[model samples]
Target: EPEVTQTPSHQVTQMGQEVILRCVPISNHLYFYWYRQILGQKVEFLVSFYNNEISEKSEIFDDQFSVERPDGSNFTLKIRSTKLEDSAMYFCASRTAYANTGELFFGEGSRLTVL
Candidate 1:
C-alpha cells in the first residue's frame, strides 16, 4: 500500500531562517494538509490544499506560511521566518477523500527545531 513520506525526519535551523518541509502524499489521494504538534500539544491543522488552492487554513497559518504542490506527487510547506515556537513535529497528511470521514494518513513527521 502507498503511504505518505516526509524528508529529513529532523531539522535544525536558526531563528528567522526559512525552512521548507517536504512530503509525498499517498498516490491517488486528493486532499492534502499540513498539521503541526507543538512539542507537547495536540496536532493542529495549518492548511488544507485541493484543486491547486487552499481550501481552509487555521489562524496559526499566518503570513509566514505557504503550501505548494510543486509537482504531481510532492507537497511542500514553507515557513518564511522560523521562530522558537516553530519547534514541533510538522506532519503531512492526506486522505483519499475528505467527505469519507475516514482517518487521515500522516507521514512519520518532520521534526523542526529552531534555535
Candidate 2:
C-alpha cells in the first residue's frame, strides 16, 4: 500500500513569518490537493493540481499562498506570510483517478502554529 507523507509534522512560527509545508504523494496518483482544518472548523480545500497545473482552487488560496511540484516526486505549499488565522492542520492528499467510488488518500498532516 502507498500513502502521502508530509514533513515538519509540526511547525511553530511568528505571526509574520513564512512557512513551507512539503509532501510526497502516492507514486501513481494523478491528482494532488492541499486542504486545511482550523481548530474546531471543517476541513477546507485550498487547491488541486494535475499535470503540473492548477486544476481548482478555493478562495482560501490567496496571493499569500502558492504550491509547486518542484520535482516529479514531491509537492509543496508555501505561505509567504503567516497570520494567526493561518494556524491549522494542513493536509496533503492524492487520488489515482476519478471514479464514482474513488477516495483520496491523505497525509498525517502538518500542524502549523502561529504565535
TM-score per candidate: 0.95, 0.95
**Cα-lDDT of candidate 1:** 0.94
lDDT of 2 at 32: 95
Indicate the worst ten consecutive residues by lDDT in candidate 1: 95-104
Cα RMSDs, all models: 1.1, 1.1
| lDDT for each residue of candidate 1 in 61-92, tens digit (9 for 90 to 100) | 99999999999999999999999999999999
Counting clashing residue pairs in each candidate, in order, gives: 0, 0
lDDT of each: 0.94, 0.95
lDDT of 2: 0.95
Worst 10 residues of 2 by lDDT: 95-104
Tens digits of per-residue lDDT, candidate 2, 19-87, equal 999999999998999999999999999999999999999999999999999999999999999999999
Candidate 2: which stretches are off by over 4 Å? 99-101
